[model samples]
Target: MTSTPEPWGPVEPLEPALSVRRVLTLERVLAGEPEVVAGAAQLDRPVRWVHVAEAADVGVMLTGGEMVLTTGVLLAGDENAQAEYIRSLHRAEAAAVVLGLGRAFPTTPDVMRRAAERCGLPMVVLHRPFPFAELTEEVQSRLVRRKFAAVSLSEAVRTALTGLITAGAPLQRLLDEIAHHTGCPVVVTNLAHRVLATAGERPAVDDVLRDWERIARQAGGSEGDGWIRAELGGRGERWGQIMLCGYRGDTAGGRLLADRAAEALVLHRMLGGTSAHTWEEQSAQSLLTDLVSGVVPARQLLPRARAAGLPVNRRTFVPLVVRDGDPAQLERMLRLLGLPGLVAEFAEGAVAVLLSLARDQDADALAAHFATRLRTESGESRTVVAAADPRIVWDDVPTGLREAQHVADAVADSSAALDLPAVVRLRDVHLRGLIRLLRDDPHVQSFAERELDGLLCAGAGDDLLAVLRTYLASGRNKSRTAQLHHVSRPALYRRLEAIEARLGVDLDDFEQAASVHIALLAHDAQQA
Candidate 1:
């Protein structure tokens, strides 16, 4: 039942003082020889305040969570009034009722006892006369101290988190601090319930993620257990929430931790500027980069991948790279295609996508579909999608990612042969692939510089270079090269003759043309 809030004091997210069980243990209250009459199961309910009232209708004045101390002096003989009094107190949501027995019909009354037991309200009876003033003073002072302590906790957490942020600490360090304060697994997730970042003990966190689907489903709304979430957003745009999984504390303190943690996170993002990616994107980028770099063993990352909500058990992993693709748009495309994948921009102008598929699914078909849909959605018909053979084991993923990147780099060569497929692979790149791999070698660089020096040093270096690239890419067909360059065959022959004179090599010789083409390809790859 909703009641009017107290207006005189602080309405912190966490309030309320001691529980009924704790209150019973107080020396002042125990001096009265208090005995549990009924409703013992609810003794743990929080007692926000102490109210001493003899009026039968005192429940109307309550704002809930009050520990009411009544003597029953107003109703000595009326059974109906006694019963209705307990019923009214229960309706008021009082934490518990302490009855002084001397003036209120001696021993426990059946009517009041039965009513409190029915409503599950803790009912206590004092055998000796107890000073209501003393109990009220002790509980209220303690409640005030608790409120002050709560304020202190809030400031402490805020100050610590702020200090970390000011020191330019990373997101993981901030989350770790929050986890240390709460002593629970902390999870930050997107609106789609995908875990973006996590901190806490590894075993406990893994336990929380083991049944993540159901837990994510239940992430919405306030739950009775230790789960508390604080919505994370600013400027009226809520993108996600921060959760305290299985936090062991009062509701108010738990919420304070969550809200403070969330505020620190939002501030971290805001201060990080535009390059500050969403936690999920950053997480994926870190994971995939590590996988491709092979700095960390794949087994160590398996748990992190799983905790991040990616399927990694006995699944087929496909590695793909898109040249100059938008990571955000690619991620959206992955979702739209109903495929399970992680997309991140691991390198400048190069975005990597890792797809986890079931063994029964056709990896090739899905990959093709992804490529086709990406082109259509992006409206870049010539955009290249490079992929490697699907890997079944997690350990082989790094090799697959490297291979896919290699394929992507190979096809990025502008001087490569024409008519490349929509999705370029290792086999499709062929000889150009080898040249790309060797583009960085000193011998290859020297060879390319030596072979291309004639045209490169000429006045119309770029113009003639384009002509030569087209001529060689067309497999030495002068007619096609002239058409592609929008020049008549006579003009093209004159340029080709000049090229042969400058380079001192015949363009018609198969081996010479092939060597020149390979050199040009290497130069282009290096430049790219």
Candidate 2:
């Protein structure tokens, strides 16, 4: 990850809208001797606006979520009119209705009270004469201020995230910015619901991810508690979503934060590079790379693995490295095998896979099975599958990965002419592997050139070198070498004579053949 200086100051979060209950508790509104007459439980409804109306059909002139202030002068005489007025307010989805006392009626109307109770609409009655203008002014001013604050908060978050994006922050840092602003758990996921990145305060993130699958499934719909999501990507190319769970602030504010975070993430990914793989794969690649680097401890990554749907406890861990293989194909193969693990592209033409084995499973057999499956499926000639020893815990996975990677790299560097086994281990390429590991040593190069100098100075074509390789591979049998190369016995004899004349050595001697074979191996390793 690239680190850049913070370009913006901290942003203060916005206050949520004042609820009907909060409005009732205001000093000005409370001074009106307001008393809840019905639907006390509905007082928490958000009051978007405060309207003062004294008419029979005020509901028609008003929109929803308004706290209506009116005297009952329009319904003073008719009981049906009073009930209809309350029903109309309920139908309009009004937050609450405040009926000013004195003049409309000396006491609260029973018809309106019964109607409000039946419809579950909050009904408030002022015990004394109260100025509707004063109450409306106070509530409207507060509502406008809240709206301004929300807009300001949106701008602040957008600015902060844009600055971070410009600074080249990664996906996790963008999510961290959202979590910091919202004081909640933030999660980024692909279309497949795989967790890409998560950020928040510590234990809260843990609690949110403990049963991550269930929570994520529930999050698909908008039924969970304060789990707000903003879609990522645009122009008909939706890729993922950003979710905030257990946000303490208003849903609107949380949504603002999520939207801003989503925008920043989309821009960051676009600016970096384009790939066919989704962000989920990128997330897996980043995690695997981090594990391989060993800069962060394995224990710290356990939570992330678990959150990504890996079973981390009381299981066997099998680390595999494949050279010249496709990681996306490997991931599909794992799913087809009903295995739970992670697959990631480690480097060009190489992939890394972490498989979770059962306690009763045989590690060697499973590794061989995986290697055979890959060979059969991919049909790539030079595929190398290297497996590390099984680990029983998550913390030991990094060690296993390092071992597998080393083996894979060694095998990749080995001579391509050698007949490699379907599944390669460190022992398979023992001596040649050591030479390749030390290929950079000046002494090794000098030895190899000195050993093969006679044949090299002859200016011979590759045919003689091919003959030498086949002869050594055939265990120094002239008949087998001739048969393998499709040449007559006398022709093979002539080639062998020419080779000995050039190198001044007997092909039939064991010590001489061994030295030349070792030299050839060193030469191939150096070229590789």
Candidate 3:
């Protein structure tokens, strides 16, 4: 599925809390002509607050993320004190330290510089006398504004996503909302890096996923250039991650968007009471449902199928529909058997599955194995897997799916009582299949109505209809029909005679009996 159309103009990317790099650019700090003395590479580190202190143990009164400003007066006389001071700042995770020089020391000190360099704490020196309060006031105000903006953005996104979840919007719609806010492609993946869903500007999203395998392999550790990732899980179990692909916003803001999206997804799953596997099934459901319904052309859906981790290129497609089988269980079984396939439930209660297999693989054997294994696993001997002829072209899958569904429908009734093959093919259903295929034909309907009209009348009340069903399904064997219906032979004979008399037919005549049975099958198939 495609992303929801963008309804508004471009959203300005989020700004992170003031960074030391940003701090250095301020007019107040720039007035002193600041020079980077040490740890110049980490300029982008966030500065939560600005502090001015000359006490060596000033790091004790501080929390992390503070940019400490000092005059170096207390640090100049003692080398150990200077080194300890830098170490303390590093341990406290201070953002950076700026040393202003005048009476404290006319220039940057080698001892303090060496300590800051060793500890990897950003150290800056003022070349001219400058008021520290000016820089502090400017940076703190900016930090407060950025923090406010971040909180407002977070709350806005959370509210939007919550509304979508409450409205019963699916996962794709939620991702679309996230992409709309971030102006970036949103990607959701399982632990193995299988892409389950994606949304964003179509071209940008396609570009991000064009080389997804390589990108996924290289993506590790913390945030990359706009690539913000958040864990998608709850209760101490992380099943996957949600990522903003090529998010060019500030890291903290990208983080906020990713985090809000992740929270919404987790809460959505919890409220919907579905597992990760169920979400995967839903994705498959959307894709397969579209394919079978033919609402969207197959060529347009190729990209989605490929992005969903299905190997679609140059493969054989085996379409199989199982009667009354669980989609989740079928998908798991496919994985256990080391096959690549997509499983989704059809509108008519049958689970439709499409297997992607290599050209040289034995498709029939694997399909049979899947059906047999599913039967064994579910302990359901009556499960019918109606198989359609494998198609080599992707465009032909819709027809194959319809054929599979039709065959499955054909077997839905007789499979339980009759000994149906584990993997029921089109030819296996024979007359039953033809009846189902022709159930909607006007002539077939008229013929069925004409032949079975007596039993279908309002006065019949389904008594003789039930007897006829059992007698016909038992292949005209009266004794077996009597035993199955839990009635004696004389009682079954009387019912059969009543059925024959009401329909103006002879049960002993093979041709008449076969016609009535076919009409009954056609009627039942039509009703189904």
lDDT of 3 by residue, 1-528 (tens): 434333334445566568889889988888999999999988889888999988999889889999999998887878899889998999999999999988878988888899889888999999999998888888888878877787877877777788778777778888887898787899888887777888998778777777677767866766677888998998889998898988877778888889999999999899989878777777788888889899988886776687678888899999999988887798889889999988888666799999999999999999999999999999988888999999999999988998899899988767336567779987988899888888989999999999998888838639788789878887888898899889999998888888888899998999999999999999889888
Candidate 2 lDDT over 23-116, as tens digits, reads 9889988888889999998998999898988887888977899999988887899999899888889999999999988887889899999999
**Cα-lDDT of candidate 2:** 0.81
Of candidate 2, the 10-residue stretch with the lowest lDDT total is 274-283
Which lDDT values do the candidates have, in the order given?
0.86, 0.81, 0.86
Could you tell me every candidate's TM-score relative to the true structure?
Answer: 0.76, 0.77, 0.73
Clashing pairs in 2: none
The predictions' CA RMSDs to the true structure, in order, are 7.8, 6.7, 6.4
Q: On a 0 to 100 scale, what is the lDDT of residue 202 in model 1?
A: 77
Clashing pairs in 1: 14-252
Candidate 1 ranges with C-alpha deviation above 4 Å: 1-17, 162-170, 221-225, 234-237, 269-277, 299-315, 357-361, 372-382, 413-419, 431-528
Off by over 4 Å in 3: 1-13, 57-63, 75-93, 110-121, 208-210, 215-220, 294-315, 332-338, 358-360, 373-382, 392-396, 410-420, 427-528
Cα deviation of 210, candidate 3, in Å: 4.3
TM-score of decoy 3: 0.73
Best by TM-score: 2
At residue 102, candidate 1 shows an lDDT of: 88
